[model samples]
Target: MVDQASRMQPTKSTSPTPLKVVAATDLLARVQRLRDSVARRAYEIFESQGRTFGRDLENWLQAESEFLHPVHVDVAESDDGLTVRAEVPGFRGENLMVGVEARRLTIAGKREAEEERRNEKTIYREPCSDQILRVIELPAEVVAGKAAATLRDGVLELKMPKAAPAKKIIPIGPNMA
Candidate 1:
């Protein structure tokens, strides 16, 4: 016999996971793949509609919606930097990737569904997988090398410090007439 209260207690070792930061080039490549998928789906939609020309935008939007899940994000700016918060429920930090550039930020994640069997016959099974991608343009430039990200409680937070403004230097020389 075990104590029910002790068995139900949550573990204290669980902590926020640090997200992996990838290069901007990698992010762009992933974006390109998503674009290709959307384009292919859009073409299929067009054929389904008898190759309609006037509804190209509609077909593209429908394709995007079908292939991607919308992510809710909030970006806040301070005098020194920017902070971004995104809702990514049911996603573990290991399943997510983040990329930051001077003027852009990208977040992408993919989670595969797991199956369990206890020697019981299955009645119905539905295929399920989750994927999300979002790219944001910053209002000000930032130091990409110093960016940091963490995921906890289904929320992802990113902190990026702003880049210093370029300084103009004037050469000191004798005045020329």
Candidate 2:
């Protein structure tokens, strides 16, 4: 009689034994991981691009705002007069206009650069911008007609004499009537 083992025929396994199984699973996982990484990279790129765009837009807006808005100033007063001091570098009396209306004083003028100086490219131009428009409002009563301004040594100074306060007259009930 022939033994059962001798009659059996060997057949190859449909799937890989052990080593190939792990490799297949690893490959699938790696592919999925690569897809996730690509997605993340795309998101990162988009976010950074958005930030850059926003920063550029903000810079432009800031410049526009500054151009539209009025220039900065320092307004102060003294006992003798309403002294308005403005920071106007490279300015002279000719470049500033100070007008006092009632208690409000307005300073507006453009600093015109000498044609000869604009052409010369210097290392440092103090307040390269030669244009200025300044308006100052007084806190107290000011003598508009007597107001005078002097722009000297980059400081626009306005001398406004304060008006004397009017006395208040209090009226009482007429003789207890």
Candidate 3:
């Protein structure tokens, strides 16, 4: 039997991981790969359904659901900028990447399956990898270079400042012929 005081000891604490900022080009490439994979899965699904012609959308959606986990997100707008919050459970910051373009934001994460070490006989085991990709379109243009992101308690938050509108200047001088 364990003593009460020993059993109540606190566990070790670890620092939070920082999110990785990815270049727009790299992010786009990753997106393209994921799209291709989904397309293949969708085609397989279509073929499995006896070459159905009218269920293209349904097949694509089903394939997406199987390959990617759903990410719940919310966007809030203020007078000066926008804030985005996304729920990404079971993902550490180091496993996540963020990309920001003019009016688009992309978040991607992948968790590799852990190796199993059995000290004793095991009855059953199942290992799998998880991947997530989510892209959001902003209502207003943002200053992509000024975007900041943080992850805490399985939630990712981004603060982006709005871009200033371009102003056209007119010459107020006499025209010379």
Top candidate, metric TM-score: 1
Tens digit per residue, CA lDDT, model 2, 1-177:
978887796766799566534677899998787656545544544465574653554344433333445566666677767777777776667666767787776655566554346567787545534444444556889878898777676777677888888899997767955
* TM-scores of all candidate predictions against the true structure: 0.59, 0.46, 0.58
Instruction: State residue 125's C-alpha deviation in candidate 2, in Å.
Output: 18
> In candidate 1, what are the lDDT values of residues 51-168, reduced to their tens digit?
8799999778867975676788999999999999999999999999999999999888878888988989999988667767777899899999999999999999999999999799
| Model 2: residues with Cα > 4 Å off, grouped in runs | 1-70, 114-130, 173-177
For residues 87-167, what per-residue lDDT tens digits would candidate 3 score against the true structure?
Answer: 988889999999998899988887877877769787777876676777789988999999999999999999999999879
Pairing residues by index, what is the TM-score of model 3?
0.58
> So what's the TM-score on candidate 1?
0.59
Candidate 3: 10-residue stretch with minimal lDDT: 61-70
Error of 3 at 151 (Å): 0.5
User: What C-alpha lDDT, on a 0 to 100 scale, does residue 165 get in candidate 3?
Assistant: 86
C-alpha local distance difference test of each model? 0.90, 0.64, 0.88
